[model samples]
Structures are given as structure tokens and as C-alpha cells.
Target: MKPKILDRAIVGASLLGILISTYALNVEMAIQAKPEYKAFCDIAEYLSCSKVLSSEFAKGFGLLPNESALKIPNCIYGIIFYCLCIFLSSFDKLNVIRALFGLALCTIPMCLYLAYLLAFVLHDFCVVCVSTYIINGVLTFLIYKKMKVLSAKKTC
Candidate 1:
């Protein structure tokens, strides 16, 4: 019994996330080609997308020993995560909404952790990264609302 408006909102947020992540990914690739490339989001020394994307944590995990493989940007994960959210939200079933709720619950912590890393460890914040965080927050709120509506439907 998820509201159609809520579903559309979720999809809209997910699409925004995907778009930002794709831009970040392109920036990442551009940086790889020309190490001196400065992203448009590189506002200041302490607020640079290139600095954050070039950092050690930009990869899957800080543990990978191979430098080349570590070049993979974390925005790839964002794209996948948001795409999954969009796919789940497209379904009208209550079970799908519940699944999206669970996914959102899991992503909230990861988003917080990434924010912490950006603020503390990296001492930098990418505009694209912050945008994705905001998108995630919106998606989480929409998913929670949809879940509540579904639960009330079940009870009544």
C-alpha cells in the first residue's frame, strides 16, 4: 500500500544520486588520465573532489595492496546502491517496500561513516559526495514513509 507519490519521490532521489555519482566517476577518470586535472567541484584546498577521490580510502577498502585495482573510485558503489534502490522502489508490493527499508537502514550507517571520513580523515569534502549523502537521506526518509504506510495497511 505504498503511496504512488512516495514511490516516485524515491525514484527521483535515486536518479539524482546516480547522476551525481556518474559525474564523480567521470571526474575520477579524468583525474586518472591527467593527474593535474582539477575538478569543477574543487572549490578550495580543503574542499576538493580531486583530493578526496585521490585519497587512499577512495577505493573499495584501504586494504587492497595493488595500486592499480585501488584506483577504482567509491562512487561506483554509490551508483550501484542508488540503482538498487530505484529498482526496489519501482515495485508496488509491500515486500519490496520492506526490502527497500532494510536497504536504506543499512546505507544510513555507511553514509555516516563516509561523511566522517570526508570530514575528519580526509580533511576534504567533494561536492558530489555531499550531494549523494543528501540524496541518500531523502531516499531514506521516503522509504521510511512508504514502509509506515505499508505497515498500517497490514494492521488494518
Candidate 2:
């Protein structure tokens, strides 16, 4: 496959994982459910998905926990990231500029949440959740680079 195609495929796969991870997060939220995958939550007494999701940070610093935040779940962000991958792959077709911006826009909270997980709260790490975060971070960078390269090609 072409590099862009390959990148998009990777992003698509990452999104699917993100979707599953989001469901796991939801399960964490709704019950004392255990994550099927290894995670930061499985690490310690304070550092669990159940703890993290229900933490004040997960609750949006105590602002919009129950409403809009729920709609914008982690998996949905994965979907959005995948959509950006699709758009980026077709940059010779869609709004590459807006999509790049949107991808960065969507990731801010994820980066923050992931940051909090790694830095402050979780004494242990969940490998799958970390993988998801790493995927998103990489996708964001790849999409940005892809957009820049495409724009240059168009000008050329």
C-alpha cells in the first residue's frame, strides 16, 4: 500500500481500538467492572480505570461530567480521529486544513486526560490504554505532517 494508505489504515485500526477502550471506560464508569485489557487502572489502589474515570478530572474538573462530556466519550473521539484519517487519505479530495485543525482540537482533552493518568494519579500503567494514547499522539503528528506535505504537493 501507499504510505498515506498505510497511515490511514493504521489510524483506522487505532480508532477501532479506541472505540473498544472507550467502551471499557464506560464500563468502568457504570460499574465496578474490570477492564478486559491491561491498563493504568489495573496498577494500584488509587490508579484504576474505575478510579480515574470517576475522578474529578474525568468529571471535567467537576463542570460537565454527566451531560456533554458523556456524549463526547473516548471512543467517539476515536471515531473522530478515524474520520480525520479518512479525510487525510483523501486530502486530494476534502477539507484538509479544517480536518487537521479538528484532529488537534479533538485531542487536547485526550492528551490532558492521558497526561493526568501518567503523571499524577496512576502509579501503575495499563499497557492497552497507554497504547491507545500513543496511537492518538502518533496519529495527530502523522496527520499534521501529511497535511503539510499534501499542501506542498498541491502547490508544486
Q: Evaluated with lDDT, which candidate comes out highest?
A: 1
Error (Å) of candidate 1 at residue 102 is 1.1
Give stretches of model 1 more than 4 Å off: 61-71
lDDT of 2: 0.56
Tell me how far the alpha carbon of residue 60 in candidate 2 is from the true structure, in angstroms, after superposition.
4.8
Model 1 lDDT at residue 56:
78
Q: Write one digit per residue (lDDT tens) for candidate 2, span 1-156.
A: 244664565467556655656765565556545434344345665445554554454444334646664544454555556665655555543365446647655776767666666566654454445666676666666656665666666687
Candidate 1 colliding pairs: none
Query: Which 10 consecutive positions of candidate 2 have the poorest summed lDDT?
Result: 54-63
Candidate 2: Cα lDDT at 25? 59
Worst lDDT 10-window in candidate 1: 61-70
Error of 2 at 2 (Å): 5.1
Listed per model in order, the count of residue pairs whose N, CA or C atoms clash below 3 Å is: 0, 4
- TM-score to native of every candidate shown: 0.90, 0.61
The lDDT of each candidate is 0.83, 0.56
